[model samples]
Each structure stands twice: as structure tokens, then as C-alpha cells.
Target chain A: MSARPAAIATLLDLPKPYLLFLGDTREPGYAKTAFGLRDWAPELCIGEFALTEDTVSTGLKRLSPAAAYAQGARAVVIGVANYGGVILPSWLDSLVEALASGLDIISGMHSPLSSVPALREAADRHGRRLIDVRKPPASIPVATGARRTGRRLLTVGTDCALGKKYTALSLTREFAARGVDAEFRATGQTGILIAGRGIPMDAVVADFEAGAAELLSPDAAADHWDIIEGQGSLFHPAFAAVSLGLLHGSQPDIVVVCHQPGRTTMSGLPDYPVPSLEDTIDMTLRLGRRTNPSIRCAGISLNTAHLDEAERRQAFDIAERSLGLPAADPMRPGAALDALVDSCLRAN
Target chain B: MSARPAAIATLLDLPKPYLLFLGDTREPGYAKTAFGLRDWAPELCIGEFALTEDTVSTGLKRLSPAAAYAQGARAVVIGVANYGGVILPSWLDSLVEALASGLDIISGMHSPLSSVPALREAADRHGRRLIDVRKPPASIPVATGARRTGRRLLTVGTDCALGKKYTALSLTREFAARGVDAEFRATGQTGILIAGRGIPMDAVVADFEAGAAELLSPDAAADHWDIIEGQGSLFHPAFAAVSLGLLHGSQPDIVVVCHQPGRTTMSGLPDYPVPSLEDTIDMTLRLGRRTNPSIRCAGISLNTAHLDEAERRQAFDIAERSLGLPAADPMRPGAALDALVDSCLRAN
Candidate 1:
């Protein structure tokens, strides 16, 4: 839209010390963004802010829009998950007022903030900006299924919010530590912002999702590793289409299964229980191998954030013994990830 | 951009003796449209026209736009296959002249003719309407994984243009003959035009492809079956994303595998050879079972049109023995299809 964004932009360059809107639906997606930003671009992120009528601690200092703007916050970043449906938030009027008061707005919701006529008019009137970070770039062609060069690893998951982005970023860091050239290919908004560039796979035209992947890793050398962040899950009923498209499009030679030890049900579907880790591994292997028969699961990235120290250690042990591959919680320091990187490098 | 269309539109009322544009790219898609129009709406079609400089007999009365308009031709229906690239046809000027001369145009190319500025300007100046039949409708929501009430079946292919639409149509007719209420759910332009209503599944945004399918079959009695037409093959390099999205979105209770006998390469990607029928079946089962573990491949639809009578019979026999399923060419009269319909009906 604006001379086409660079493959990635420097988020830290944006006017920051920002306000993150996490409304009433504060799930792990919201948590991941808050934590990932602090880790990746702490200088830009000021603090967390919620729009709920009742007070809720996000484990960070909270601020109202007016208070945030008064304290050097020039932008508001919305990470709300409940943007679907026609229900507008009670705090929306005040948020629109904040847009009119000259604070730039950034949203990662599927529902574009530009769609709100009142907010659009307010932003225009105030000469402020509204950035829908989830919107994919225009005019990506249908995938040609061109043979991909270089080594690639994709992080898949047993469910949404199961540490796919964290695993990919971790792997990329490990590859970097090993002095191997690697880049984190983000597929969602938070990851995109963290990595400074990647396609919003869910926002793309269905036909071009794979093409976006192909374009992202165009003509890599045999030694380079493109560690791609996968979205959704094969078991995620609401979003498996996105997951499958990314999996096939990325055409990874090696895959890492990211899982949470304490989860029993799918992210949103309570009626649908999460499949066993072995089955998830099996499905990933089966689906990924459709395009690349050489695809193998190099390791497991366990998300033990919700588990205690004892439970977390048990998860790592169970995952390692059952899958017989390197397994570790990506959020914590572990040797399993380093082993995975070594194996993938050796295989390549 | 206008009011949402009904699930199906009655094309019988359109001005008759229509001109069908085959153009130079007469692959399987073109041939299917030509023969399908003859079978479904013969009275509406007057002639076929190709825009090749070389002499090519299309076995129909060749008429120029002015010449066709001199007769009873009131519209031009395009089914060309070479619409992906930026190259316009050599005869495009004359075709636009026809559009300016008041011939309403209908195109099924992935490239939207409306996007061509000159043609759009000409059509606007002349008050002639241009209809892109493959454009997906306005915003469709992400699938809610709603519990569907009626039975549904989807026909997947081993490659593009391998008789997915034909198999679904055949199954719909078989159900009709058995006094069962059923509808053929089209997901592409030709099938949409033939059935009088359906989504252009490939043209949809990636997130909403499955939503389109979910929206197509809202609710029906247990006895009513919705036979859905699938697009692209699971192994197709260029279009597998569409195939996977449709499969997940349709959430079919039963699946049908469509294949072409003696075809060695993918329809477009010659470098990518078609997998063995056994492998295709296994892949379909593996993917489809992700959504519905109860999902079963009910039958196989063989496109033996390229084979002689003896060869066709041999092809069907090989498919039946190898897959252990009833297999037949939908274009030919056979009990295999009837058996499939009966099995699905009984299963429902």
C-alpha cells in the first residue's frame, strides 16, 4: 500500500514506549505478544494496557490510553483475540477517542481497524495512522511449486498457542549460535513484528498462501536455514486450513513439533480433545512428506510454561523417551534444542 | 459488489444461442466446458470460437463477434485455461470490440478480465456487462466447526481436471434416480454455471475457503446429500492449497477419488509426475481423516475419455482391483457409480 513494505521493517524504529490493548479476552496470544515484545524489542514497548471494566493485572504496569499518551506513549497496539463477530467492545468509544486524540493505532486482529468508519475518520481527522499488521502484501502469485534450495526447518504444533513461534525463534538463535546462517520466517503478526518481516499467512488469499512461503525463502543456498513459524494446528478445527497451507508451502526438510504438556483440549474447541503427541507427530510427518518425502521430525519443543518444575521435567523426559528425539522447553535453557540444530545441520 | 447471489442462479433465462470462447488453450478445462454446455444447455449455445492464428478445427461453426452478433448470439462465454500470466490474447482487441458492441462477457479465467483497464473502460463506455464467474463473494467468516445436520460428500482428484466436478454431478444424478434429495455443490466456475450456483473456491481468501463450503450446505434432512465438487489435486504443485482447503472446509462424510488413466504427469507441472493411484488414495485418506476420522473414500471416478473402449474397461478393472472400491468413468454408463451412491446413501 505504501510502496510495498520492505520484506521486514524495523519495529523498534516506530514511535514506541507503546500501549498494548489486551481487552477482556487475554489469552496466551496476548501473553505471547507482551512477552515476545519485551524480549525482542523492549525499548519500543512501554507497558501493557487492558480495556476490561474490572481491574486485571497483566504482570506489568497498566495504563489508561489518556494516561499512556500523557506519559510519552504515542501509539496503541491492539492484540485482542475477540475481534471477530459484531460485538464491539464497551471501551471502543474511548479507544476511538484515543485515535482522534492523535495516537497512532496498530492492530493484529483479522477485523481491520480501517473498516471502522468512525475510527478511520478519527485517524484521518487527527492525521494519525492505523496499521493492520495482519494484512498480507498484495498480488502474490499462485505457488509454482518450484524446487526450493537450502535447508529449511518448520515449527508445527499440537494446538494454537503451543510455542511454534518461540520454537522457531529459539531454533534460529541456536543456528546462529552454531555460526550457521539462519533467519526466522514469521507467519503471524507478532512473529512478523518480532522478526521485522514475514507474511501474515492467515490474511493471504487461499491460493497464494503457499506462494507467499515460496517467495519468502526465494533461492536460498544449500547451507542456509529458513526457520519458518507455523500457524494453527492440524487438529485446530477452526484454523487447520491455514496450518496445512503453511506446512505444504514452506516445504521444510525438517520439522519440530511444539507442544504444551498441560493442555487437554484444543485452543478453542472444548469438545475436541488434543490428540496424543505421537499422533500429532505422525500426522505432521504424513502431511509434510506429501511434498518432501525426506521430511523428518528433528525434535520436540515443549511449552511447559503452564506446568510446574516437576511437571515440566516430566514432560521433557516423556517427550524424549516416547519420540526418541531431542526434546526441551523452548522458553527455558535446554540442551535438546542444540542437539536438534546439530542433527538438522548434519542431515543437510 | 452487488447483492449477494442466491446459492444458484438460473442461466436458462439468459439470451440464447450464446457464443462460447475456447481460445487457443484447449486443455481439459476447455473441452469439459464445451461438451458440458452441449449436454446441459445445448439450446443456449450456438457456436465455438478459437482465437488461434493457425488453422485449428474446433468442430463447431466459427463465428467472429460481429458475425455471431449478426445471428442470435447475445453473449460471449469464455473458458480459456491460459489466464494466469500477464499476457493478453492477440485477438483481445477484437474481443473487447465485441464487448463494446454490447455482447455481455462471462469469463472463468483466474485472471479477472475486469482488471484489464482498456476492456473495463470499453465495457463501461458501451454499457456492456463483464462477469468474472470465478470471483469469490464478499467476506466469509472463519469456520466455526458447526455441527452440520445433513450428509455431504466431496470428490477429490489425483490431478487437476481429473473429473472432480463430473464425479460429484454423477453422484448427484445417481442419488436423484434413487429418489433421494441431493444437490451438486460446485466450487469452480464451470461447475457453478452448470449447477446454477456455487463458490469459486480457488478465488477465495485462504482463511475463508472452508467457510465458503460450510456456508454452502447450511442444513438439510439426514436423507439429503450434498455432493461437493472439489478443486485441484493433493499432489498438484500449483493448486494443492485449494484442494486441501476445500477438503477441510467441506468436512465431507464420504470422499471420492477422481483419477485419469494413463496420465503420467501433473496437468501443468510436467516435472512433477502423478503419484500412483494407491498413493493418492492413501494421501487423501490421511488428510481427510484429519477433519473427520470417520471419513471414508467411497469410490473412484476414472476419467478414461482418452482410452479406447477396451482400454477404458481395463483401466476401470485395474482401479477396482487395486483400490478395492467401485470405480467407473462418470462420462460412461456404469453400475459402479450407482453402487457408490447406494453405499453412501446407506451409510448416511
Candidate 2:
């Protein structure tokens, strides 16, 4: 029999030096992954490029999928925008070319790349690996209302993509720097790829969404904080179920409200305006108590990226005064990292 | 070749006179399924009984699952309580016996009978059918936050089994008696079995829980009201996700809050006290606006079954006075049914 390739345990450990593929997809999710890895985990992401007939800047350089391996890339992380409908028949050949070149392939979409017969055959022929991060794992137990004994910090957002993952990471980093035993539990594909393991909360069946969270933040030693990445906003009509489920499942003792100062309306729904930061904090605290009665709004993870230096300072000041919480961009220096960490530690 | 059986388009049109199976499992879910049918659609329920070696009363009479067809039972509806574990080996034998006797099988448990090899084989051998009511249908589209035009009424509750189902059914009956085209849309197994078709909201995956509601209450004529049954209480630690999901998914114009006067605390979590009627209404109205901004809490459905006649009347008086909404035991005449109808019609 021919030699068999070892099963890849975690994408984080995958021979990265990753070729980020943003193929003609301008969805914020794709852009975020490209920019997030480039900014935060640049050491893992070797090159940023896309393979598409349409010559768009994509804010990244262009490289054919066939040329990925030659460009010092060990794996290709495909961040295509469209998860709905059929995968373009046109993209398969390029993918097959990449597989033939011995590049491991990864995707974070509803359509399983492994389900495509030709793609599967191509990977099998070249002894390469294909990972679909959105495929929910088997035998996830139904969430029992077991009161976990560790302190948990969950980063909830005003809407999707308001820097929940980023805030969670920042808090985890801060906690680690302070010599605290803290962990960042990822809930999305991008988080999973960067952090090595996490449940794709959206991909999980609704009934098990909470169960996934319960399992993700397994009981840690007391005083250790699990900074869990939260999903959608509770006010988002399209995705509030996931948001609420994550909130309840995490059973967090400390909730960090993540909001972008410039988000005037609910994402994608112009008719629905975003709730005021105060309203979000009030609602989140109330809802969070349904599970964890002691849950409190520890601080505000303000995303003021769209504002100028002066405007960001003003917005942060308003958030701190109006919401009566420490507000700051976790990524920037002189942010309210001290207040957030102290609040969590004090709660325990 | 052997002759093939005819396809079953809808169980609603199947020979009525269903045999209800309790199976020595006296879980609240089973008793509700049996009693719900006995009260609302008695014409369809030919018999109600249990089958078990334990010989417990199960609060219902005993019958052999093997003896189902002999009792003129066209179908055996299994509402066993233990859906958590591997279905007892004893259950499969009885289920197989029913299938062998040419009785169709219907179950509303997390542990699906269709997954049993012996039962499937028996059904195949006898040309009988197996129906798992909790099995979600295919291609349930993600909720788009699309505005659905039509009047919808949802009965929310302070806790599970606090008369949400009873309230919805009562309102539908009251509406029809008044010559309005109102429908009670079931979101659980008992309601589904009673009404013949509905989305089992709790069984649905977390992400698509709202989508199930959207599809269940399709846009009706402006005059028609789809009174949808609600699930778990928002304050329930074990199940708030389902409650919040249903609330958002239904996008109801009118909401009726259901409460049991005797419940001093939440169902399982004794530490978590049930909110007062006023607080429940306020929180519900606030959260409901996340989806439908114009949502109104039209009335309170009080379940005062544990109270004496005078106590129930007094409880209703207290609820109405405190909530400042029409409050009543919907089962009783001269309650708040007329006021609830007026609220929905007025909202329209």
C-alpha cells in the first residue's frame, strides 16, 4: 500500500505561511479574515492574494491559485464571499491545480469543498488535505444547565463584525501579559484558524449552539478567565438567535459590549437602527442574567476605527460617560485594558 | 416483484382515530400530548395508553403497542419522556411490533425511532411508515429580516408549561367563534399532532429556529391572524435561547404573556425567581421590538389551575390590575378572549 498522509489535528499548526485567497468576494467576512490575519497574525499569513478573472484590487496583490505553492505558501485558505447557491464551476479547476501542487486547502463556507467529487479526487490523487471549518463536529451534547465553576468573559457586539474576535484576543493577551492564566476561546473560522481550535458557532445546528459553547469553555481552574468570542448581536433580526444562544451558553460572569461608534444602522438592514450603547448594555445585562445572575457589563470594547484621532477620543469619552463603563479600543495603547481586566479579576 | 405501498402525502388526511402512546414515561411532555388531544381534538384520538414491563400507571391506561392495530389505531403516536439516553431496548421491540402490525409510527422525541434498525426493518417489511415529527425539513433558508405583512399573534410564557399552548388554542377558538379566520400555529409536537402540521421549534437547530417560525406563519390576508404557539420562557436558564428565538422569529404584531399564578420560581432553577407580570410584560415588549418594533403585549394568559375557583378569579384580578392588560384563564368563558381579539384587530 502507498504511504498515507497524517490527519491534520489543528489548522493553527498547519504548515502555514498561508496563501490567503480572497476570490472576487468583497463580503465583509472575507475582507475581515484577510485583514485580521495580516494585521494580527502576520507571521502565519505568508502572502495575501486572490485568484479571479475579474481584475479587482481586493486591497491585496493578485496571484493565480496555481502559483500559490511557488510563492512560499504551504496552504491556501479560501475566503469566498458566497456561501449560498452553487460554487462557481469556474473555481474548481484552479482549486484542483492548487491541490496538485501539494498545497493543503481550507475553506470556511457552507458548501463543503470535500463534497465536490472532482475536488476530492484531486486532493486524494496528490495526497493533500482539505479542511472545511464550517462542518460541525459530531456528538456535541445538548447543553445541560450545569453551572460551570470558572470565571468567563464573553465579548458581545452591537452587531456582527464589530471587533468581537479582536477584543477577545486583546483581552486574552492583556491577561496573559499580567501573568494571569487566561484563554481565548474562538467561535468562528477565522478565530479557529488563528487560535488552532474552536467551534464555528453559526455552522452548529440551532439546538446544539449552546452545547458547543458549553463544551468550548470547559471548566478551568478558578481565577482563570476564558475570554470567549461572541457571535451576532441580539438586536440583529437575521442572526439574533445565534447571539442569544452564545450568551446563554457561555454563562459569562463578565460581558464586554463591543460596538463601533460609527455604526448608524443595523448591518444590512437600513430600516433598523442600532440600539444606543446604553440600551445594548442594559439589554445584554438583563438577558445575560437569565443564565448567569451575577453577570455584569464589565467594560466597553469600543471600535472607533472609522473616526479620526480627535473624533475617536470624543466618542470614547462619550461611551465612558454615557454608559458609565471603561471604553477603549483594545488594539490601541492607553486603552481601557486595565479597567476590563481589573473588573473581571475583582468579580472572581 | 412485490407490490409497493402508496405514498403518504399528509397524516392530517390519514384515517383518524390515532392511538396515543405514553410508554410508561410520565414526563410532562407525554401527558400534555395525551391530554391536549383529549381536550381539543378528541375525535382524532381513539385511545390513550402506555406499554411497559414496569407497569406504572403513567397517569393513563395501559395498552400494548403490539395491540394497537386491533384497537382500530391507524397510527401510534409515541411521546416517550426519556429522549436523552439511548432509547431503551424494550422500546424498540414494542415500536417494531407496532410497525409489523401495519400501524404507522409517529414520535416527537430527541431520540428518533427512525434511527433504530429493527424499527426501520419492521416498517419496511410491513409497508408501514415511520414519522419523526422533530426531524426538520430540508433547505430552511436563513431568516432575511424581511418584513412579513400580515397580522400574527404569539403567546409567550413566564415559564414552560405555563399555558402558552392552552392560550394560543383558546385564542384561536375564540377568534373562530367570533367568525374570524384565525389559525393556531403549533411550534411543538403536541400542537403539531393536534393541528396536523407545524414547525417543532425546540427541535429545530438554533440558527434556523427563527426561519421555522417565518415559514410557519406565512403572510396571510390582512384579516387573518396566525396565532403561533410559543416555546420556553425567556427567563428559563435551560431554554431562554429557544424562547428569545421564537419571539424574534414570529415577528408578531400582538403578544400574549402566559403565567401560572402558583409558580413562585422558574421551573427547574429555584434560585431564579420568576419575574412579576409587569416585569415580564415590560421585558418582553422591549425584547420583541428587536424584530418587530410595533409589537404589543395584548394580554396575559394566566394558568391558575392549582388555585381554587375563587383564588383563580382573584389571581386574574391581580394580574389584570398589575399588568394593566386584559388577563384571564383562556379556558374559561368571560375571561379576556374578547379583549385579546380586539387588541389584535385594533393593531391591524
Across B179-237, the per-residue lDDT of candidate 2 in tens digits comes to 98898898877788888677777766667767767777877887888999989877766
For model 1, the stretches where C-alpha displacement exceeds 4 angstroms are A1-35, A42-131, A336-345, B1-35, B41-106, B110-131, B335-348
Per-candidate iRMS values, in order, are: 7.0, 10.8
Model 2 / residue A87 / CA error / Å: 7.5
Q: Which parts of model 2 are misplaced by more than 4 Å?
A: A1-106, A118-131, A142-146, A335-348, B1-35, B42-76, B79-104, B118-129, B334-348
lDDT of 1 at A110: 57
Q: Cα lDDT for residue B163, model 2?
A: 87
Enumerate clash totals for all models, in the order shown: 3, 3
- lDDT at A62, model 1: 78
- Colliding residue pairs in candidate 2: A206-B205, A206-B206, A207-B206
Contacts from the true interface found in each model, as a fraction, amount to 0.42, 0.38
- lDDT (tens digit, per residue) of candidate 2 on A1-348: 212234422212345667776656645654556676666566666665555455233345556555657777887877554545234566677778778876888877656777789988999999998887776666665666678977899999888888999999998888888899888888888887676567888767666667778888877888888999999898887677788878888999989989998788888878788878888888888888877889988888888777899998898789878777788888785646687667666743
Worst 10 residues of 2 chain B by lDDT: B2-11
